[model samples]
Target: MPLFEYRCMKCNHDFEELVAATGRTKVVCPNCGATSVEKLHSVFAARADASPIPVPAGGGCGRCGDPAGPCGM
Candidate 1:
């Protein structure tokens, strides 16, 4: 099962749902009972055992000599 986020256009309510593969396309908003619910992409948190990742900023760090922060140049 996967969790998906949905926002209702009619009532402007946001909610999440745990659904199977077949139920992903046919979800309805529970708050407003409207079929105009828009499904949103779900974001998952990184696991504890995951590798240390580099930050994705454009500039480099001036204080630490690292690419973690923005370089003023």
Candidate 2:
């Protein structure tokens, strides 16, 4: 089963669902118990075990303006 993201139109709640296959499938919102929901573009996260995350060139730390911050530029 593949996990997919969805947003409830009735209550405006966002959730994830384990879908069988890609198609017009009915999904219920767990928060609002509404059947009216819309599929959303899922953003997946990856585990970088010991590997350094690449930082864009010249674009100082995204958070603090310091270049030598935790998010090294």
Candidate 3:
């Protein structure tokens, strides 16, 4: 299954739904119960680097509670 983003053209409502990849699925707006919808481009995350982003001294590394961050124990 894949998640899809849709906007209701009739009601202007935004919502997400999980659908089967094999066939066409009917999408309906939860807000107004309308079948008129437009699929929106989905955005995804990709790591540019393996290392965690660095935080300056005294700025806590949110993950490990370190004041200076390189994310290493």
Candidate 4:
């Protein structure tokens, strides 16, 4: 099962759901019971086990440094 993020267009409520991939498209807003909920594409940082990888401080792009931009990349 994959966790999916959903946003309600009617109530503007955000929530997460754990559902089978086949059922993902059938999910509706739980708060407002509306079918106008949209599945959101989420960005997740890679993790090792339960530990989060440390990011270098000082606003530098640890991956590719060429003067940091607004996105820190």
Give the clashing residue pairs of candidate 3, or none: none
lDDT of 3 by residue, 9-69 (tens): 9979999888787898898999999999998845222232445576666776766777655
Q: Which ranges in model 1 have alpha carbons more than 4 Å from their true place?
A: 23-25, 45-52, 55-73
State which candidate, 3 or 4, has the greater TM-score.
3
The whole-model lDDT of each prediction reads: 0.67, 0.72, 0.74, 0.65
Question: Estimated TM-score per prediction?
Answer: 0.54, 0.51, 0.55, 0.51
Whose lDDT is greatest here? Answer: 3
- Arrange candidates, best TM-score first: 3, 1, 4, 2
**Total clashing residue pairs per candidate?**
0, 0, 0, 0
**Error at 19, model 4, angstroms:** 2.3
When 1 and 3 are scored with lDDT, the better candidate is 3
Query: lDDT score of model 2?
Result: 0.72
Tens digit per residue, CA lDDT, model 2, 7-63 = 999989999987777575678999978998888855342223345545557755645
Rank ordering of all candidates by lDDT, starting from the highest: 3, 2, 1, 4
Q: Per-residue lDDT for 1-73 in model 1, tens only?
A: 7777889989989988777876436677888789888777663422322533334456565545576564433
- In candidate 3, position 11 carries an lDDT of 79
Model 4, residue 35: displacement in angstroms? Answer: 0.7
Candidate 3 Cα RMSD (Å)? 6.6
Off by over 4 Å in 4: 23-25, 43-73
